[model samples]
Target: MLSDVFGDPATIDETAHLVGEVRLIRTVSRAEAQRTTRFVRHGRA
Candidate 1:
């Protein structure tokens, strides 16, 4: 999983604990990542 590969160790562990499996979307653009972070923090996409 891309998240499993790219996520911070703590985030990966927490997600694994909750989800039981790590499934992640592959190949996101830098702009997309930045947009996602902004949306997550600001609640607007």
Candidate 2:
């Protein structure tokens, strides 16, 4: 299955998978939290 998805070893492009940095926030404002409250109740944004 690995060979079927990745193809040949020599032809694979490694640079295509470098996705840079990912940031995670620790806090949010009251308005921002209220906006997200509806999504939690209705299962959508």
Candidate 3:
């Protein structure tokens, strides 16, 4: 199963996997958290 999913080495500890998932979630969510509700492009016709 590990080979089918991860392939090659396919050997990560539970803590490492959890940390990777948390990092990815934070990275993906950071853009949304830092975005404003309005567009800011002006005076450029």
Per-residue lDDT for 2-41 in model 1, tens only?
6767587788778676665323232345567988998989
The TM-score-based order of candidates, best leading, equals 3, 2, 1
Candidate 2 local Cα displacement, residue 28, angstroms: 7.4
Clashing pairs in 1: none
Local distance difference test scores for all models: 0.67, 0.54, 0.63
- Residue 18 CA displacement from its true place in model 3, Å: 0.2
Point to the candidate with the largest lDDT: 1
Which ranges in model 1 have alpha carbons more than 4 Å from their true place?
Answer: 1-28
Error of 3 at 40 (Å): 7.5
lDDT of 2 at 34: 81
Residue 38 lDDT, candidate 3, scale 0-100: 28
Kindly list the per-residue Cα lDDT of model 3 for residues 1-45, writing each as its tens digit: 666665566354664688899999998788655553223344332
RMSD of each: 12.6, 9.5, 6.6
Ten contiguous residues with the weakest lDDT in model 1: 20-29
Can you write out model 2's per-residue Cα lDDT over 1-45, one digit (the tens) per residue? 555776875434442333221112223455578879978889987
Check candidate 3 and list the clashing pairs: none
